[model samples]
Target: MAITKDTFKHVDYLWDDEKAKALGDDQVALLLYRSNILGADLRITNYGGGNTSCKTIEKDPLTKEDTEIMWIKGSGGDIGTLKRSGLAGLYMDKLLALKNVYRGLEFEDEMVALFNHCIYDLDSKAPSIDTPLHAVLPFKHIDHLHPDAAIAIAAAKDGEKITNELFEGQIAWVPWQRPGFDLALQLDKALKANPGIRGIMLGGHGLFTWGDTAYECYINSLEVIDKASQYLEDNYGKDRPVFGGQKVASLPEDERREQASIIAPHLRGLASSYNRMVGHFSDDERVLEFINSNDLEKLAPLGTSCPDHFLRTKIRPLVLEIAPDTDLSDMTEVKAYLEKEFEDYRQYYTKYYEDHKRDNSPGIRDSNPVVILWPGVGMFSYAKNKQTARVASEFYTNAINVMKGAEAVSSYVSLPLQEAFDIEYWLLEEAKLQRMPKEQPLSRKVAFVTGGAGGIGKAIADKLAQEGACVFITDINKDNLDTALATYGKDTGSGALMDVTKMEDIEKALKAACLKFGGVDIIVNCAGLAISKPIAQTTEKDWDILQSVLVKGQFAVSKVAVAILRAQDKGGDIVNIASKNALVSGPNNVGYGTAKAAQVHMSRLLAAELGPDKIRVNVVNPDAVIEGSKIWEGEWAKGRAKAYGITVEELPAFYAKRTIMNEIISVDDIANGVFAFVGGHLSKSTGNILNVDGGVAAAFVR
Candidate 1:
């Protein structure tokens, strides 16, 4: 707690006075400190939902005299990640001046554009729409949070009465009003009526709290939220029914996950009809209680209460209806049923849009539901990418908490449909949507790279990730796998130990990749070794090893990838890394060349076999990639150098000189070749070989 705490059953007191003292005189810094502490707890606020601000005295640049300025959280940023740069600073005089021109409620949106004129710091981040809430308040420090506990009280049928009795009129209640100038004016009027209230519950919305000092504001926010949480928990005792009691028992934990994975890709395909999307699955305990509850049919259709959650998750979730404990053993039937539900959802959304479209409303967006509820499994959230999908899931979780709290205390309520439609299609919200950067080519795609520890594999993984694909890299080298994962980033990729030749290892790695990201859209088989020896010198073991690692390894990885792709019903890409030797023959390279040839044919065979299923297989032939190559680790480089009558140091030059273009091949060249096949350029051209040899005439397809 920043100031006071007797005890809080639902939240912890984390404020350190010593830390606040060290931040001396920097009111904005104190504001950030307050924002971060509240944001750290999901119970207090949702991601990117709440806003905070402080009005502080600072020397004005032009006047060279003490002047008041307001520092508040900017548009489209999370308070937890707030920084000095993220806070939009405006002159208090200019901002207060805005009240003079304030028109009635119908013109509230026009006031938002005027905020730019009030800004004193041109380089500061743009102010959020909620700026009016913080600016119009009388207190020096203010917080506008979407705490589930407070929203529970805000959303209950008897919210206003409950607010009066719960806090002795210390916390007031303002009925639901869309956030803008009008809401700010309403709050200001409410404060004037009740001179000493600490906070107010924004009906069907969230909580607002303020204090004279930064520390007091932070403490006040926690005390109000914690007290409300404690009240809800005390009234909603253990024996009380949650979500009108469970409708059906949960499936076993392992079974739930297994079913979720098997069903995710189909759901992804449906969601991606208008724009591609990555998915996130959550089986959190609380989510289960609600999804498996009897009241879901009655409550789910009412939709989420918070505006933030509604914007991302849509007006309501799409429910996959089936009798309780319906058999999902056959995914084909489940997928068909889901398809029917999806169509009905789209039709309903279109009707809602038609019912509310104004003359200036932006065109209808994708009709797909962002959130889906499956009774026996869990929740599935979809977005343009993984982090967004995960965040959408989290916001829905907050909505769940609010619903549960409200149901326990009073009848849970949702915002009226007209109010929600206005917020969702507001011209301001549409403008913000237009400002988002264009999606990358591989925005919602995922890649699986085998032997990612090697130079070529790592280069390919990096390229895909740069093009905006999430990668899952696996290698037999544990240390190298860890290093590769570090570079790929936590959001971009995951790592695992895998030997392609081992069936069990391949299965484990595939499962791990599916668990990290939903599934793979592209597969890169780059794992191998080169064993160059004359027929007389090559032993049976040498030949066996080469074939086992190169030919059989690629086959095994492809087998699992095809299964996943089929389950998704989404066509995929398989790129096999072969070599120029596969086309051009050479002496003392029998074993290595034979394996490469098989790898080449394997690509073509699979391409032909999987073409009907929309899976494309292609090959990239690289010649003499020595630097950072796992195949050239020990004797392979020396043997090639010896055969060419050059030192190992000169092998690169020798190989380069042999090419028609006299250029050397690098891992990046091979990576570009792989990109060429799968990076949407030649997406239609498969069962083909891309030679990255700087022009090897002998290896010409003709």
Candidate 2:
């Protein structure tokens, strides 16, 4: 495979002179472009799995002298979307000096002190662990990535041989070494021995390439990777062994998603610690193809293709065998199986840690499995937050690709379990963990908000997410749901189109919430309907619509949610968004008032019934919350304003003056009342009513 201009044509270099100049600094601009290009391809770098650096000369403001500085990717930032702040500036001389004086210091202590003391900019974040490797390299631009094509070769039994054959002495090969001072020194030695080497392959780790310019470094990486890809294609692209014996043929899409929904909550519960776990299910062609393969049990448990993945996905994924005809409704059996599986996993992990952990290494990570492989369905990745779960999902997806590719050409292999353990408990990773914020009040709680696409429901969902609860929202309007998800962010909240009156819709939404997040810890029934009419003028259709949603809808959602909570053997919360009209009926508001009154009473009855299970039921009766309220907009607001002898624009002021506090209620005020109950602040107070009506004397509840 000769290197040509079109050899790496698949990559987009994004080379516009005007656009590049606008980025302020030419080197910074080129580095950003190169990082994005490399990260754009998942085969190159998955999520935050790679780093890049550039060495440049800058004049120090204080010293009034030219200084050589190294700009490397900082911790906790994704390479695909890296910006100026994502790269930390370090004085190159100070970074390289640590190698001589730090011979006896612990790796963690030396690295931390070096990073803290050596600075080109005091405000910039700490540089990546690979900064030293970059510092010692003799190139101006450097890129280190775990591309799948290259990893296929590096993780093979004859990886060094294959690398030599492909690169023909153009690149040096370094055997697997836990990345730190030692690995940096080893790489420096390799480069020094082979002065003409353009790149280096770290067996079972990744690939590194360098050049005097960003384009040269990036293209060299691509060319080297292309060679490896070509080698696999020529050797194994044809007559590959097809792993047979799939337990069951793929199910219909709806059934697959339903199965995913049913199993998600159980997995989440198993994965949760202090923070409830969120799950991301993927049945992408690659994932499904891998899961459905006959060699799944053989390949998945072998280990992750790269050591970096051990941090996100442990060495092995938990594989659960679910028959095609298994009953998902009977969670009793499923729950039992998961609990036993988790116990066994815990014992195994403890023993594994005991066997491999170094004296000063951090304690074993949470024993819960991050990746779960379900036969006949797909895979589920669990983490405390959605972003981490999504990243794990991507890692598994890439792992499948790399492993399959490796097996196609030769046998697939990974680093030894000891090596994986070393990386998993590395002090560099521990430092990153220390920087995360403390868990929030509702960190482990999951909340479902009905009518969450609009004013009050959206507000409640957003607030719950802000407090660290993984929120699942439902609304009848698909457009509104999409818009709300777009605004609130898909990671914080997921939207489901649901008509609460329909039993199937209600069940499906609940299942989705369970699957996406774990079982619900909090339920806020914000879905409601209003019709103002005298008792005689209230048509059956009008009355039933309000009754079905405001009364029946709350009952249906709560029934399913409570069952999930009970199954988890955890106490839960249920807050109904009732109305002040439930206490003080306005003129010609018979239907709305009657239904809301029934809802309030029903909540009290549920409280009494569920109290033994530690499920608290309460009502927040908010009146005249017109601002940003879909319920109070348009015809409803106009009619209510007319009832008050005022125009629509004056309705809020009119209601405000009517209340003792002269304050118009807002959606956030109503949300706060709901949180007060669901957040366990009102733990002992159930079957109670909280008012956000600004002291409506007639509607006051003692």
lDDT values for all models: 0.87, 0.82
Q: What is the TM-score of each predicted model, taking all chains together?
A: 0.94, 0.94
172: Cα error in model 2, Å? 1.4
Candidate 2, 406-450: lDDT as tens digits: 776667888788878877887777878988888777876788999
Candidate 1's displacement at residue 437, Å, is 1.2
lDDT of 1 by residue, 234-348 (tens): 8774557888888877788887776776677778877877876788888899888889998889988999888998998998999887543566567778778888888999999
lDDT of 2 at 604: 92
Candidate 2 segments whose C-alpha is farther than 4 A from its true place: 1-18, 104-109, 236-248, 273-275, 683-685
TM-score of 2: 0.94
